[model samples]
Target chain A: MSDSEDVLATAAAWRAAGEPVALATVVETWGSSPRPAGSRLAVSATGKLAGSVSGGCIEGAVADAAQQTMRTGSPQLLDFGISDERAWEVGLACGGKLKVFVEKLA
Target chain B: MTPALLAALQAAQAAKRPVALLTRLSDGEQCLWPDAALPGALAEAAEAALRDDAAANLTLDGEAWFVHPHNPPLRLIVVGAVHIAQALVPMAQTTGFAVTVVDPRRAWATADRFPGITLIHEWTDDAMRALAPDARTAVVTLTHDPKLDDPALDIALRSPCFYIGALGSRRTHAKRVARLAEMGHGEAAMARIRAPVGLDIAAVTAPEIALSILAEVVAARRGAALARRAAPAPAAAA
Candidate 1:
């Protein structure tokens, strides 16, 4: 299955199971970002995750933000760039920039 | 999540139809746009997105909407389970085409020869009818036998298949053309078949021939516009 389909299916399954779900989507990308725009990551309230917005470079941060979005019932936009020293710590060694939108699925 | 929207998306995916999911990122309002059946409410925006076959953010009436195009995988239908097919099947699959090898010769079209691929043990005409080639489908006839290749070419020529290739030499193709003409197909219709199949790469081996054929198919699919642009301009009037 495609990444979008996988994320959608996982989100639907979580919603059916009475767990709040939030979806993170890569809205924009620059340079050699591992994933392209429209890449997605689905996170459930219980910390379960499916799909990917990055090649493990920034998924942890996105998941944490997604879980927070699920709890707050609000959306958050995150921007990550390799220019930041912290990006190296997070493993974005490809020197690209990406923006992800995290929102609770209603 | 709206169950109706999800159901519609899944239905289109199951049918191998192209679809686009338009989402209003601000509020998570979503709608499904199946190809050629865009909702009247968002016809213009959806049409634009489908044309590009790419996901993009569109602002219509000052609302930001992201259009995610979900296209079905491309398909390749080989009309003969010959030696070339043994090499071609894996190459096409690796290039992301769902391939099916069709041949009535059960002895040749065995699972041992084409493991993990769809093998259709039916006549060329019957199999082509059942598998209905679409715009994203490529049809090739590797069998030199006219009885096998002609029927497959007849169906592919009439269909909207993007590429139609037939394996033969120039002299052999001339004979095949005469037969097709006798079958009532006009020159315009017969022109669709890529006679003497594959690019002129002097390919003699099975694998080399398969590579040339696939290269031609890919060029047909993605380089038509570029090929047109590269064509020499007509002589200027003196």
Candidate 2:
């Protein structure tokens, strides 16, 4: 199975177990982003994570947003880049821009 | 996220059929297109995504939907566990191909030589029948023996394998062509076999030959369209 399939399967399992789940996907990338546009990360209500969005640079922020999306059941579109002043804050110093979409999974 | 839709996706994936999951970002309404027969505007987008073997967020009717293409893994079947096969297996694996090395000889097709690669201890014809090379598969014959290589080529040429190569010299390939012709294979069909297999790289070593063969296979797989685009157009008839 592919990485996306594994993440989706895990998210499905979590949802079946009555735990809330959220999926964060890198919808777009510019410059030297570590992961491609379709890279995904699955977050469960208990803080369990599967897959990755950025090679450890932005997973923390994505996970945080994913957890919040799980709690509030709302989607979020996040942008991070070296040009942004908050790039160092989010740890994306790879000289690239990434647009991630986080959504709660039913 | 319905149980039925999820089951369908899993079933399609397990069967090695091409599938795409179209998920609307706004409402998260998901639709799975197992084959080419998608509905309306989505069909064109799904076909393009499948053809490109890429996943993207496409906008249609002013709505955004993520078209995630879930294609089956590409496979490489190498007949003859020679030195080139030894080097080619790992390289093909690293390049995202599920490789299988086939050789009937027990000593040659041993696990000690191939290490973690999949080894088939059966004749080429038998192995080819069992594996059933599809369009997403590539077959390479390195045995240099007509007895072993011809049978594999017969099956590979008949199948939808994207790349078929045979390791031999020009004179050997000429003899092979005559032999295959006697078996009723026409010029067009025989043309598909890349004898003196691998690109025109001045490769003298086994590993270098394997690298050239792999480069040719990749070129055949993904570069055919580009080649067509770059080819000069035929003159128009008066």
Candidate 3:
């Protein structure tokens, strides 16, 4: 199975175990995004992570957003561009732009 | 994401069925296409994305939605554990195909010979039938022996496998076709077999032959217009 499948399965397993979980998916990409649009990162309440939306560049931010989504029961659309200072601060200096949708698994 | 929806997606993937998950971005409402019976526009969008194995964001009725296509992993079932199989297995794996090598001869299909590979020490026909090659599956028979290769070709021709290749000389392929015909395979079914298999790249070595086969497999999968093989016959010795 591909890594995405493993991520989804991990997310499901965590949810089934009564752990709060959030899924962050790359909804769109521009230029040289490290991962494609469907790539996913599954984050659990206990700080466990499966898969990645980028090449270790912006996952920390996404995971942080995932935790926030889980706590607030709201979804978030995150946009990161190479030109954005916030993107650089998050280490997304990969010369690409990406939109990630983070939603708590209810 | 509802637990039910996530479980359904997992079930579809485990069953190797192609499905698309449609998400309403504005409200976080999600549904699996074909399962929930999407509207015409959404269905069309999902169909297109799934066909390309891509994910896209589209606005249907002025509402932004994400269509994520989930497809089964590609699989390759090789019906011979030969030297060429040795080369092709790793190449196919590198290309994201879960490969299985089948040969009844225990000596040839040993774990030592094919380390870390799925080895099926069964007759070709049985192994092919058990595998049940699907649209995402490719089957290649490398055993030049008719006893091994013919059974695989027969099973593969009847299946929905995306690609079926047989390694042999032109003369050998001709005989194989004749045998398949006598076994009730029609001309159209036989035509599906790319005999003297591989793109005609003038490949001479085993690894080169493996490369050509992998290239042709990718071409077939991507629906690329294949260049017809030039007449020197492939180096897959009969």
TM-score of chain A of each: 0.92, 0.95, 0.96
Model 3 reproduced share of reference interface contacts = 0.68
Sorted by lDDT (best first), the order is 3, 2, 1
Candidate 2 C-alpha error for residue B112, in Å: 8.4
Ten residues in a row with the worst lDDT in model 1 chain B?
A: B226-235
Candidate 1 wrongly placed segments (more than 4 Å): A1-106, B1-8, B34-43, B47-52, B199-208, B224-238
**Counted clashes in each candidate structure:** 1, 0, 0
Global lDDT of each candidate? 0.82, 0.83, 0.89
How do the residues B1-238 of candidate 3 rate in per-residue lDDT, one tens digit apiece?
9878988999999887889999888878999977888889899989998888889899988999999998888999988899999999988887778889999989899898889999998888999999999888999999899999999889999899999999998788878878998999987787788878999989999999999999999999888888343344333544
RMSD of model 2 against the true structure: 6.3
* Tens digits of per-residue lDDT for model 2, A7-68: 77788788889988888888778899998877889998899999899988989888889989
Model 3 residue B179 CA deviation (Å) reads: 8.7
* CA deviation > 4 Å runs, candidate 3: B81-100, B106-134, B154-160, B164-238
TM-score, ranked from best to worst: 3, 2, 1
Q: Between the candidate structures 2 and 3, which one is better when assessed by DockQ?
A: 3
Better of 1 and 2 by TM-score: 2
What clash pairs does model 3 have? Answer: none
